[model samples]
Target: MSRHIAGDMQRYNVRPNCISPFAWSRMVGAIPTDTPEQQARVEKLKKLGTKQIAPLASDAAADVTAQIFAVHGNEIFLMGQSRPIRGMHTSAGWTLETIAGRVLPAMKQNLYPLESSNIVFS
Candidate 1:
């Protein structure tokens, strides 16, 4: 969406960028810490304040567009744009068994863990 907006509005000199900011706000404070992992994640988040995200929204960042920035604490990370990381092709197409036996195992290394944003970024 940011890429589309940035392209469409480029002629008008509008640059669209996205910021994924994490801060210990009321919303975060309400997260259930039922497990040890959750408790640890919450503890880490507590160290980040809303102020850490201000710089990315400032005039200094006007030149940056169609980019996703992850803000944590005093750190600002320019995240990679979405794109295919792996691919598989076959002239025979694929059957359920083939996919399960071939594709799954081949692609397993590239799969991302089922973790929350807090855990992933941290």
Candidate 2:
């Protein structure tokens, strides 16, 4: 079963870390700068889908810093260095309704609920 799942997950390209704090805006390099409301847009998209998502383009980096991890039935752990948040579960991926369905679990347990989780980027 593990081998089978590994095969299924192998096709998904594992992107290295690109997420950074907002202070690193000057480090965008070749990628275009974010709009003034990028944070708010990210927050809005957080409600729509994708918080800890893979970068948009090959050159694109510096998406939102917030991320979801861990698992417990229908819950995703919103692991924050500053604060711990949780999300309601879904088929998979970030969605407000799914995030909104959070069923908070015990503290300091770094994990989230998913059917088959591979590489998680936070």
Measured against the true structure, the TM-scores of the candidates, in listed sequence, are: 0.66, 0.15
- Mind giving the per-residue lDDT tens digits that candidate 1 earns over 1-122? 35778989988878778888787888899989999988988998898887867767787877877988888888888888887799998899999999999999999999978877864664
**lDDT per residue (tens digit) for residues 1-122 in model 2:** 13344345445643333233221222323333376555543442234333333333234533422233333223345444434364344477755654445532432265655631212422
Candidate with top lDDT is 1
lDDT of all predictions: 0.83, 0.37
Model 1 spans with C-alpha error above 4 angstroms? 84-111, 117-122
CA-only RMSD, every prediction? 3.9, 15.9
Q: Using TM-score as the measure, which candidate wins?
A: 1
Model 1 lDDT-worst window of ten: 113-122
Give the runs in model 2 whose Cα sits over 4 Å from its true position.
Answer: 1-68, 82-122
**Candidate 2 clashes between residue pairs 3 or more apart in a chain or in different chains:** 70-111, 70-112, 70-113, 71-111, 71-112, 71-113, 88-98, 88-99, 88-101, 88-102
Candidate 2: how large is its RMSD? 15.9
In model 2, what lDDT does residue 32 have? 37
